[model samples]
Target: MPSGPWKNLSADFCGPLPTGEYLFVVIDEYSRFPVVEIVKSTSANETIPIVDKLISIFGLPKVIKTDNGSPFNSHAFKEFAENTGFHHRRITPRWPKTNSQAESFNKPMMKAVLAARIERRNWQQEPFKFFRQYRGTPHPSTGFAPFSLLFNRETRTKLPQVPTYKPNAVDECARQNDEVAKRKMKQNATFNNSPNDIHCGDVVLMKNEQKNNKLAPNLDPKPYNVVAKKGGMVTVSSTSGMEKNVTRNTSCFKRIPNTLAPGSVEPEVAEGEELILERKDEQVPISDSKSMPMQNAAPTLAPETIPKSKPTVQFSDKRTTPASNVTEPYITRSGRIVRKPAVF
Candidate 1:
């Protein structure tokens, strides 16, 4: 639980409504009061404005918790969180339980939506009523109504008319919340937490959540070496030298038993000064084109066949010939051939 209302808030998207829209739900961790916004598109551009509108009305939260959704993970949202001076906590991928409060809230909210749909009621108006009623009702864990805790006053409702009741003191509610949280933490601590404490150099098979290819397995068959571990995140380098940082809870990585302990045997190094596949001055011909560059292969065009030059045929200017100097064979008036003039 948060120390105060709106200090720690969780947000999520619940959707595919009848209209194919999504509901962006934001809830106060301590008060359990929720604010739902309808969104046509979940893109960062669209989501940031909606969240900004809500945050403007209510003061900024110290920490904003969200799942690894596109809008939440987007650069725009990250920048928004930075500019607004709030810590953004992204829950482990594929593990909604990491943000249990948000996930739990999503269930009841969706159920109510479905029920309202079945009844053919005015669903758009239902969220407001639901939020109002939920705020008024006392929570089982907190033992105080969200409205009373948040506003320090009992919310007016259509219930039976009675005298005004005083709200629970904030300090008293906080103390009670701390105690309940402590109890729950102790209960959860009973479960084994060995996976959470991964050490560097540990070989683990990280979960494969990437679904780009359908044929890929769910978990990596090959083991990866853990290079770094920071809180719930670990940086693992695969056997093929690819490295990735993944959430500890989301990956659910398991250790692979090693036959040989690390550093027990010195890794093999090339004994000679030269590497096995090192390039040499001497070029040895090989049958395969890949092994060698095919130096002896036939050239595209043979040297002899390649014509060095063509015979030059220089011609006098054909246009300079005088038409008058040219002799013309002509038919005479009586069909006799005409000849060059004797005087010429």
Candidate 2:
């Protein structure tokens, strides 16, 4: 049975890679081989031609799967696929498991592309070289190069190798068969975890901690729909309806409830076209009565005058006549003063 993951190329190149930009990728579920093509755009008009060419080269796959993105789910692409008789399967709304093959391929391709751009500063032409190296290298699990698997033959390359004696034919055949069985078992396990098992319209929290941490608090905790689930991961879409891959564990995140303090009042939104306060038109009546002005009356006072003193006795004029006849005061034994008669 041809049951395995396959690459689904979506024509809607709405990313910021520039107008008319596009990315074409190929995936092999069993080998996990991925090939990417960068184009100008993913528009149906532009994509049809590319798809035709790829199909012609790779042959038609049983089912072509993709995310529920616009380009992949566009009416035009659907019509085109119907006409071509190819099954067009879309992954659940926000789920990515339906197209995990292509999505997984993008990771390494993006990393390599980024590294190339960093080293060369001109990465536009580096994809081809990287693709060639990747396809040529032997896969760790398959032990077969993608080029060899796709072409069914080993490509010639000049490389040094130690000469070794050939093993018995039977031994080599057994070894080869054992390797194939191991690869098949791994592929089976991968398909068992297909994302399609997730139910439609499931509410899932997306792991956006990295991107959200860089955003403002008001912009955080983006919600998404669980469009698909595969293994431990789920594909989620933002409220704006963009899909992204997220781990199932992260889909459990819930919006924190808006809470208020027990005694606090929540503010209400004010309504009404315009608010105008009622004001009285009349001016306040003021009393005109005035207290009588203090009169600037002059002070009344009496004039100051000096008092006359009486004259002392004139003893100096009569001193010449009274020198010899002047009476003298005498003190008696009892200490009393007495006046003596003239003794000239």
Instruction: Quote each prediction's TM-score.
Output: 0.47, 0.41
Candidate 2 scores a C-alpha RMSD against the true structure in Å of 34.7
Predictions in order: lDDT: 0.72, 0.55
Candidate 2 local lDDT, 11-99, one digit each (tens): 22223453335577756655455656677766667666777777787766666666666567688989989887778777688666556
- 21 in model 2: Cα distance from truth in Å? 3.1
User: Every model's Cα RMSD, please?
Assistant: 31.3, 34.7
lDDT of 2 at 316: 55
- Regions of model 2 farther than 4 Å from truth: 1-15, 18-20, 158-344
